[model samples]
Target: MEQRNGRRLILLPLPLQGHMNPMLELANILYFKGFSITIIHTSFNSLNPSTHPHFTYHLISDNLSESEAVEKDLLLLISHLNRKCYEPFRECFASLVSDASKEPVACLISDPVFDFTQSVAESLKIPRIMLRTGSASFTAVISAFPLLQGKGYIPKLDSRLGEPVTEFSPLRVKDLPVINSSDPERFFKLVHNLTYQTKASYGFIFNTFEDLEQHALATLRKEFHIPIFPIGPFHKCVPATTSTSRFLSQDWSCISWLNTQAQKSVIYVSFGSIATLDEAQFLEIAWGLANSKQPFLWVVRPGSISGSDWLEPLPSGFHETLNGRGHIVKWAPQKEVLAHQSVGVFWTHSGWNSTLESICEGVPMICTPFFGDQMLNARYASDVWEVGLHLENGLERGEIERAIRSLMMEKKGDQMRDRLSKIKEKANICLRQGGSSYQSLNDLVDHILSLESLALIKHD
Candidate 1:
């Protein structure tokens, strides 16, 4: 570990699993670069501090009721957090600033969803940088929301779902991000706040590399007019270690099972931490995997299947149909599983982290996006990148089985793997010393250090 520089950088992460993992990974990266780390988090879905012993942890009440704590509507929960966290965060931040013994504070880094942080950082005269946890292409789509809405494209008409979003090539009307709420205005308001506040930050940090998203990055730089760093594949930038950010315990036994399977023969299925399926849809997936007639390792997160506790709703003789061909776990070490030689295909929800991880490992995907930027990511994977197949229709066992065979037991799958191998090589090259990501990381550190001088100028 690099020696601490006695300058602390504070990070506030959104409480969701996908959001928290990247933030914590970035925290670890910066810590290894020699800055002291402090994490300010909400009491709901609180992180275990012992897991990240190197960092200082602070908790602020989110004012969520027991029911609200288990709220399925993500937008409402985020709105509540924005409204309630402002005062507590201000107080907590003030206390941190006034402490005489701690290192001089450098700047505040936070997930862009917490738009409230921009005002708080301004009030305290602290520089704030926003870390975008999604793809640059998705950010481009978000930045164009007003235009898309003005053009009467949003609140997407079911009739137009298959029509092209002319402005966003290859993206159809249904590929736009969505909220699962009765009030559409609420989602728009949140988007407006997120986009407006992020533009006010000192700089934007994305967990993507230039080679993978050159055009999107170019568009973003022109729009935001702030320093943009595309330093990513963050997990690859650092050594693999036990992650402190997981909400579910990983079942390592799956690795041993993968070991027994033939090379590039096991299909790995996981839909990320969120994204639920009804019992009927869940049954379709279970049967689909069985019907694929290939060895598979599936991560069926507890509570992810609606109206069922764990695997209670699994159909009769589901295991016998597989005849020891499938392995089911509540969770598995996803990166390790992806890197395993026996793993050939990833059936995913196209969550950005999972997408990038699959790309890094040269694994082709079968995308069944649930919501938000997932649809857009899935479109890019299947339509643009040609590294995955998109199951645009709702789940059915026959369709699932065919999609599986096309990727796992056919020439189409070989073509996807070939394309992904090239993309994967580009990802690896960008991490080397002279690579775009390597240089961007250095620039990011320099930018953080320069904030101290900017602060000194303000004080003087």
Candidate 2:
């Protein structure tokens, strides 16, 4: 084995914004802890290495165009990348290992989507940890796919949407992750392989603290034989030293706009980096925000509406109706916006990262989940943690308006805020010294160092 100065880790993020952000936060945390990071990423939604000059970046060109990603079906896009990435990823990984001057690669950390890395890491004789950048509860629900399938619950019927998920406690069928496909069986099979690969990993890393998800963490440990580490709310553990925006240029103007509003008077709206809405739903949200008569900071991403470049053609006089009351941006610095005193309620798609960020900031949420883990996360936010309200029966303007008003103006919103304050305190505690998340992170480093030592001994 070659001698090296410091431990070097390789990270392969899933390349979507929601998936990539938390992984990068993990990279930041590892880098702060004296581990060198090498980020091997795909061409679509790639991170610029120059912006993050400290980390080494390797591009595994998937040859997927921006237009192709937007046009292709979500499942098809993932399937295509999985097939195309394996060879290039193998080559890049092999080259990294064979290089003599560089630090001997200690371990590989990858998003669960890149489960193929388990095999590559095995061949290269390195430890691999699959980072599940969502709550342990959400991952537990998805990991129960086989149970749902055996009970004939998946390939779910629209009629059965209200049925309670008996295998998992306190969740209804509507709370389950939606696999939008004509062939639901095939999609389930594809995801089942991810769990299979996770079981083969050296360990499992979750972006959640133990107290925040006690039962779910217990369930995951019981279900999967692998060691599980709940070492996060990573954003709080590692402060953002610079811009981490991979895709959208953030609009900082809203921070000034937020300051002008009354305390807890503004509702923050963002549906995550992906998840495009149809025209009707988009218009409904617009009218709803307008009718609520509350100040709002809305992040209308460029391609938020299908086939549209902007929300310019919103309902007639939509801007004029709430001219002084609303501030719109292509994207807002979400963490800062949530932490702002003026931001009362968050109207969100309930993506896990967004969910945790809102909780960490003690901000309550109005969940309008789109698909996949979002459904499960929305349920946890509204039901388990009691920090949010869900928007059921789809997006009608009346419902949207009422939800905004209820969360921002009514007593119900105050109750959720009180609950969130306690959760926020708990999250902070977990990341502090001698806390659960802190100890877990230390354990992770120890495990990596042990693996590296064992590998060196074998080589010697």
Best by TM-score: 1
Candidate 1 lDDT over residue span 231-315, tens digit each: 8998987656636487888999999999999999999999999899999999999999998899999999999998887899987
* Deviation from native of the Cα of residue 372 in model 2, angstroms: 0.2
Candidate 2, residue 80: the lDDT equals: 69
Lowest summed-lDDT stretch of 10 residues in model 2?
Answer: 1-10
Question: On a 0 to 100 scale, what is the lDDT of residue 272 in model 1?
Answer: 94
Q: Kindly report which residue stretches of model 1 are placed more than 4 angstroms away from their true locations once superposed.
A: 455-460
Q: Which candidate is the best by lDDT?
A: 1
Error of 1 at 178 (Å): 1.1
- What TM-score does each of the candidates earn? 0.97, 0.95
Model 2 superposed RMSD (Cα): 2.7
Q: In model 1, what is the error at residue 349, expressed in angstroms?
A: 0.7
Mind sharing the TM-score for model 1?
Answer: 0.97
Q: How accurate is candidate 2 locally (lDDT)?
A: 0.85
In candidate 2, which residue pairs get closer than 3 Å at backbone N, Cα or C atoms, i.e. clash? none
